[model samples]
Target: MSKPLGKILSEGKTKKVRETENSDVALLEFKDSITVLDGEKMDVLRGKAVINAHISAYFLEILEKKGVPTHYIEFVEPNMMKVKNLEMLPVEIVCRNIAAGHLVKNYPIKEGTLLNPPVVEFYLKDDARHDPMLNEDHFLILGLASRGEVKKIKEITLKTNRILSDALKAKGLTLVDFKIEVGRGTDGKIYVGDEINGDSMRIWEVGTDKILDKDVYRKGGTMEQVLNTYIQLYQKLLGKMPPIRGTKNE
Candidate 1:
């Protein structure tokens, strides 16, 4: 097995870290714990780490097969992956395949509006300000990204969404909405960062408007149960067994 290189630099809610061989790289440990309601509550959901790793690994594998540029290298275990430590852009790329939630609430669109060409929105990643929406000009004015970089990010984001959405649909899951974060590596190559989980997606029941994904949490579902449902749905879609992990509290 390839040994890790450096010391862990930072950690996030979904992933932990250890150093990798590369100075600008690390091993990301995707924990079984989950947070929701904007990190207001958390739970150590049983088997979550394993399920998350499997889901992400499977998705990234598909993306790579479909020729998307990402930071995935190799899986270390049920809970870990080898990846580059990237300098993240303080923005979130939101891609909507079908309209619901805030989109329906904020716009005059119907609930199940299907966007022919996926709509992409950018948001400032400032939690304190609730991640306010921004435009391409905001990126230039804030000096957060060059015009060229912004264009590149947009192009890649759209391509990523298109490919992933099609792939998921083939597996009977509608890729309603999802978020992406981009970052720069030591060589200045832009790659995707962060875990793409149920929290980052807005999946819905294929035939009904019944919601799945993070909307469950928003709709008052318990953290543990909601995340488990997500894992189960993902596993069903991928036609895989749910890897068993931590024991559930009786």
Candidate 2:
């Protein structure tokens, strides 16, 4: 169903908006759009809408099964889901299982190294500000969350990372890293909100160096191929027939 104009709420890179029947809930229409390098106006990957919808639905279902709090209700369409509206926290939680990118650039660390306990990093959610990294002390200093809340966030985030990593590994994809955002409800309980699609994760091929994330688009790779890979992975997880592979744009 198209979003009723009176109920339209917020819209992001790959999703549209509409208020749901619940006053505090909204309907999210995931678009077939792809962005890279943190929305730096990168090329839009074709077939992204279908791929991301499948991926997000699968992960949300997984979180529901694991007893974690989330905002998702049910998929209303091939590219839409209903969820609770939340006062989104102004931080992006990134948990890295392998050393890569900024970690190597900012610290004296070797690339492809393993983080025994994994590394949980936070950044301000301000897109214009370039999402600066933050520590626990920084989180507290900014009053973004209380000490107890921060602890709870860490616990949930790490748990999510571990579970998704193992899950992707089972499908021949290594979860090198991923980003998450949490929001608090009126009762002060944190629910995993926002989209949890393939766009928010770094999925790598197990044996080879094939990357299935938006990185493929950032590097000017085959957008259609990359998006199809993500959709294929999601289809595999959901026990559904995958979409026919489309010809790559080269």
Candidate 3:
């Protein structure tokens, strides 16, 4: 919202990466659009970009404070953040603390089962291929990541899970499961990249089955309903809310 950014570097279902003046930096612009089922379904909701921009930044900021490496730099008002440029890994690291979705669907595990020590898994980020799950060998053999890189990412991913889970628990939300993308930074270190908003994770009200994340959208909830849950999450997680549009702040 300052001077305009350069051409778009890359784009996806819910965000865009734009070139920045600094070669080592990228301007991440959040989109109002939300998608699921590997983008088989999509919708745009007003104010979604702003909500996700702040929510994801808040989560990554928490991770950075707890000694996790990340690409987060500074958030731009409305719907953008500045972040370190890096070579992104073509895989997603998922950590599940509660059995749900694919965890229960693909296996004999029951939904809502609390996974002890949690379950960490990897999947190739190929939407055309339905993002098939991958093991360390598949990751290595395909030259996606080295064995040591895999081990290192698992450490970071689990640590991220604990950090985020505890943070949400204090706000009376359950951290069900989440997916994250990693990238090698200019410093030659692995840094969590992409975004970590509700769209990339699941949340349920503590002690109840009330859903507070994107599952509502995937399960046929209306746009207004989907955003209401996300707004509730922002209020509880950050203890603050952006001023309502058409207000003084607007």
* Winning candidate number (lDDT): 3
C-alpha lDDT of residue 230 in model 3: 82
- lDDT per residue for candidate 1 within 1-250, as digits (tens), equals 8655445567777778777657666788877667764567766666677777767777777777887777788777667788777888989999888887778989999978889888889999876787899888899899889888888888988888887777767866688988989999888977877767676887766676556576776777876767667766666566756657432421
RMSD of each: 3.1, 3.2, 1.6
**Evaluated with TM-score, which candidate comes out highest?**
3
Question: Least accurate stretch of 10 residues (summed lDDT) in model 3?
Answer: 241-250
The order of the candidates by lDDT, greatest first, is 3, 2, 1
Q: For residues 155-237, could you state the per-residue lDDT of candidate 3 as single tens digits? A: 99999999999999888988999999999987778999999988889999988868988999989999889888888777788
Ten contiguous residues minimizing lDDT sum, candidate 2: 241-250
Candidate 2 — which residues are off by over 4 angstroms? 1-6, 239-250
Q: Model 3, clash count?
A: 0
Q: What clash count goes with each model?
A: 5, 1, 0
Clashing pairs in 3: none
lDDT of 1 at 146: 86
Q: Which candidate model has the greater lDDT, 2 or 3?
A: 3
Give the TM-scores of the predictions, in the order they appear.
0.88, 0.88, 0.96
Model 1 spans with C-alpha error above 4 angstroms = 1-7, 246-250
